[model samples]
Target: MKKEQPSWWRPWVLPVLLVLGAIAVQELMRAQQPAPFSYSEFREAVAQGKVESVLLFPTRIDGHYKVGPGENPRTFSVVRVEDPALLEELTRHGVKVSGVVPDSPWMSIGMWLLPLGLLIFVNLARRGGSTEPGGYLAVGRSKARIYAEKDIPVRFSDVAGVDEAKEELSEVISFLQTPEKFRKLGGKIPKGVLLVGPPGTGKTLLARAVAGEAKVPFFSISGSEFVEMFVGVGAARVRDLFQQAQAQAPCIIFIDELDALGRARQAGPMPHEEREQTLNQLLVELDGFDPRIGVILMAATNRPEILDPALLRAGRFDRHVLVDRPDRGGRLAILKVHARSVPLEDPADLEALAGMTVGMVGADLANVLNEAALLAVRRNKDKVGRAELEEAVERAVAGLEKRHRVLNRLERERVAHHELGHALVGLALSGAESLRKVSIIPRGIAALGYTIQVPTEDRFLMTRQELMDRIAMLLGGRVAEELVFHEVSTGAQDDLLKATDIARSMVASYGMSESLGPVTFDDGKASPFLETGPSRVRGNYSEAIARRIDDEVRHLLEAQHARVRELLGAREAVLRKAAARLLEKETLSGEELAALVAEPGSGKPLEPPARDAA
Candidate 1:
């Protein structure tokens, strides 16, 4: 497509015309300006009887005067002289001078400059606007950051995790590189590929990787940039963006955060809204663009559910590749890729670290490595150690440690028991997470102590029994406090919160309630940019049903609480010993905690309680 050459008279021509017009107006106005004279000259004119009429000011005078008697007078202005007889002199010369009159000072810079500024502004505005209707020029231009092939150093090798997404985009890159290969195979290239995923899942990065691999011009923009305050401007921008893309064939147009622009149009007619017009224009452009010409439109959005149906239809963005969070294996690849440059001293097992970060995205894994490096430097360490990396992960997950927050002896001992309780309970349960570390050291704002559980392997599907075990583990700390001190502290607040949330999710979300049957209480309405909408709870169920849900939640918690209490009761001696040792050490490893809970003579698991007798 040939680019349109701007009119020869465009930018400079308009400003010059306006400036010349202003100068002409100024000169014409100046021609009719009043002439200035001295007070003495005015007095002479009056004495000579050549004055017609005079308008007197406090220190100035304005009137028509003549050089010869009976001649037409010319307008002139004069300052007053020090002489007190000026008025008497004028009266003596038969000049009809009026009484004193007040006039404001004029000919200020602001008075003349105001109109010039206005003219300049209007002329520039007319020239500045693009060929848009009502001439909204800059607003209608696309805000895409065009990156030449050499500018983007990110290749497919730099991208890790989301392997499937990479595979899907390979076709796009392939088509761009060798369109003939697909054309011979009777395959028309896909016009658009929509990357749908959660945030930090590397959607934008993957698009860049495609551009890098294909060696195409990358036009990156955000969806929000297309829409503006003015109507029809968005539509104009959409057209401008496509025109530019067509000009740069074999280019990638990556629209980030596309939901902001392509959100589903409201059911009612809103024809005048700028957003609606913008969406319509985008739809038209997507349909009009030819993928065969090597212009592939790629967009990313975490909230794919909210996108307009027309935007996601067969012709526009037919192929939607889900760039979901990386699994354990993918996270390992991502971590390894990010860690390639960092110097490591006794580096942690990337595989183990990856196992610990089961649901982390590629971006998150990258941050972990960067944060680990920063933490090492902060501690005056020359190289990244496993301990630093682990601490970084902890920081990433639980927030930074507040080590300076000192606790009293009694509270510290209590916290030891509380954390160990969780560890011991976790050790007993088969489905529970394996212990990583337990600390009496305060971490983050709320956690006085915490038991870090590292999973042996990532499990996507959890059975009902597994969830029940998780609930039991969460209650263990509270149960330990109740059994040992006969009262629980607020240390169990976070644990209880997690336990309650799990129990409620099981009832209201998972449809696990026997009373509620196989029906979930959640309204299942699609929420934008959130896991689920918390506001729309307790729907499709009555107040009575809601009461039952409350009962069911409380009953679940009570059952888990009872189970935890019984488990702690049987292992009371071990709990006391571990708590005591924990107070002395102020921290414990998984091995040490396991040894503390081990049987007196054997390494076998803690034996379940003997049958209760009446």
Candidate 2:
């Protein structure tokens, strides 16, 4: 990105200009002054008859001395001395003399006023150059970026993955385009629409689409821009913002991250007065505005739970639109939209790619495509191919490939067996996600190997058996290490943690434990839109119950470990073959892994193990 140039007039320029002007004035005064003459030199010049004229003042005498005939006379000044013969000497020399008055006091006054005038001019220049709306003098002015109807290029067609939100906003667009349509039925359009969703889900983009579709002005600002250290400034800005919005009637005002300003006010010893005042002003504006005036207010926030109640009530933000992450079909549409500019080798299989990115948001998908394009450029490829896309997915999921991280012979063998173990278990289990690929090549921060699994479709709810299979798949690496090498390695540390977490959740939160019954110990108060990791268990349960929950989790993991040991032991020969092939190639696709697992061995054909009661 190019750096922004500094303004021509800066605060530092004032001091610099003042210093330069002072020096220039001093030099000019010095240059215009005559050379100083001692009293004795003046008397000697008079005796030599070289003194042509003299001007006498109370404290000083200015005189000119004659030089060579063709040259101009040189001027000089001398301090006036109390000599009685000075006038007589000048009279005897026939010197022309005149009496002059002292300098005026206004000269000293003007010297001080000159700097003051320059200071004022510099200050004016600084203010004049500050064209941004958020300048120092305009602190209370709204810092919104206004876009005219012609300037907004994004329409409903540009936004995807939030079709329901788009449909909900369609009415607002119609209202803005023709307010008379709603006025005929005495129907009042919602004064404000709150777009709530997880971050990167395109809430702001959806708001822009509304403005574009309506072909009206769009005013965009952040909620935090309203508040400042000075109290009441936030309220002033709120008023200013709404005033501007009203002037541009039939417009959409979009405030991103509303939680910053509309957070629920607290009654405490140290309250945020500025923020509270800002919120109050916003509430007043929302209540005061007439919906029929054609000014629609819109805001977006990920944390809707923390917003003030008054701000979300009926008369204010009457409508709440959910701009959620795209599903499989939505993901495909988003991919198609984003891929319009990207050059593809054969029109890549977007449907399959979308399936692989199960939980990615719009931003994440865009990043994946961008990463693919970058990878293609780095490899000197003219177009992004399937390989680049697949690699980009792995990079996004697993992290950037650490090709420089070389493993030893023993470590490579261990990683190969570890990853193949996951693939075998995932493939054998009915409830586990389908395997995409397994690779022993080191990637990411500390992952020596990784196994990619893509869900067949988005599943919001998981069964107990599915959860069990997931935990078993997680433990497969550690189980493989123990069964093959007769010991476990630290390579399974992350797997162990994930398995333990799932087991604990199954017992405490999911209420899957028979001993715990149907009671849930978790508070379940975390924000629905955010991924806040594990739910915190409330203290309602007794200490003995906690101990039982821990025991159940341990027993659950142990049973799965034993079950995996048996499954892997039964297919020992196939495991060895797959691990060997994996070590040779360092990567294997799901089909290749399935074929290797199906190879005949001393053991019988693998079957899905019966679900065990925990």
Candidate 3:
């Protein structure tokens, strides 16, 4: 039979061995004092310079001198002596030496051995631990963070917009907070809820709110964090994460950007084996957890289609909540929430602002309000006014004005007419708003002059006639350039791009084009990899139909141009006067412009500035 090693000397014995060895070395290298060297006896030798070098080292085996400036340079010899006597003797002998010995042999040895010993012990421990069934490697540990209800600061009040999403998630809160209420009659609560929406639409916010309302521990992490370089690490992490969640009970696990870890597998060459394994483990964990035990798993992602089918099964991510952009009523609510903290000139005319921000998401609205407040603070104003907010909206949507690029007088004059033309036509159109101000003064990014329109009221849906009128308004700037200056400038490049996008969207997405019927041609560029829409693949529309689409767009633009010219012809004097006043004042509001346009003989401005759109 083989002899058995002592239990203490097994794999965990290195640290003990190192500590014993370090103590032994230290004892052997202790300092020892020696008889003093007499200076008088060495003075004659020093005068003759016979003592070329004098080195000092402590009296012990394996010791070193603390190297210093004052030392005999010629000879190589070390002497050990006591403290006071050694100093006196050295002075008598005319031999120089440093103050003290800095290092001992045992200290040098310990410095090198201590760290090496620790590493060796660590390695041994790791190997020994690996001998177990699951092994010591932390490959399957979950990266999700857990927070108790007390830890989560965000509540439903913190979130704005997406009332429908909020209502849908209320059930989730009810289940987690009072499970008995739901399970009383065999009503099984959803095990998982996947919040899906466009970027910045408050998906994550809603999930966090659920965690807060439930008053349970919350575990949050991004989907990307699950993936790693080692095989099966992600899977291991997934297992560990869910196991932890089960232990906590009454808890939430919020995985942001689920698309990263849960993307639909492809048919081509297999990729990221570890990631797949991790996702598989996540699926298993999701199924294994008992929903009745108060463990609620909430996840968020902009792309929902890419998640694994197994993860989306009935027992997994059962409910899919659509957190879409806020509608008109939602915007008003969002405005009210944001307005609470801000000092507004007139409570922001929220209904009007919402109308102007029809397609804006929750994030965009927040940014708009923030930008407005920042502008007010910059101007040393006490509160944000409508002017500041209007400027903020323009800046947020169109970017800050690039006033640094200098334009010559003639260029400025042409830009003035360009803007004047747009304002004039918009004012004269039945459905369009009158020009509030057409300024030649340059503002934020790349604009020479801007024709700002102030609508009287918010309009949710635009009729075909109104769309045509808007198209005319868009083309007015370019048409005016061609008519008055006899040449079109690149200044209208941005205008052209905007007009083209609107026309295309109207035809392809909005189904407003008569030639295209009511069929939407837009591909809906929501996801980068998704290819379901027209953008993914070209449609079967014939080349002739494509030609007709182009012709229709051009006809729309031409009709608008004619309308602008006819309108401008009647308001030529008003156009010059407005541009001149814009140049003088630099900025004007709707009321101010109305007063100017209402001048006894001035042309009538568009309908009293309609409230902004939502």
With a 3 Å backbone cut-off (N, CA, C), the pairs that clash in candidate 1 are 129-137, 130-137
Give the alpha carbon lDDT tens digit for every residue of 178-223 in model 1: 8999999789877889999888888899999999999999999999
Off by over 4 Å in 2: 1-135, 535-542
Quote the RMSD, in angstroms, for model 1. 5.8
TM-score for candidate 2? 0.80
Model 2 lDDT per residue over 238-324, tens place:
898888999899899999999999999999999998899999999999999888889999999988989999999999999999999
What range of 10 consecutive residues in model 1 has the weakest lDDT sum?
605-614
After best superposition, candidate 1 residue 132: deviation in angstroms?
14
Best of the candidates, lDDT: 2
Error of 1 at 334 (Å): 0.8
lDDT of 1 at 325: 77
lDDT of 3 at 295: 79
How do the candidates rank by lDDT, highest first?
2, 1, 3
- TM-score between candidate 3 and the true structure: 0.71
Q: What TM-score would every model get versus the actual structure? A: 0.82, 0.80, 0.71
C-alpha lDDT values of all predictions: 0.81, 0.88, 0.72
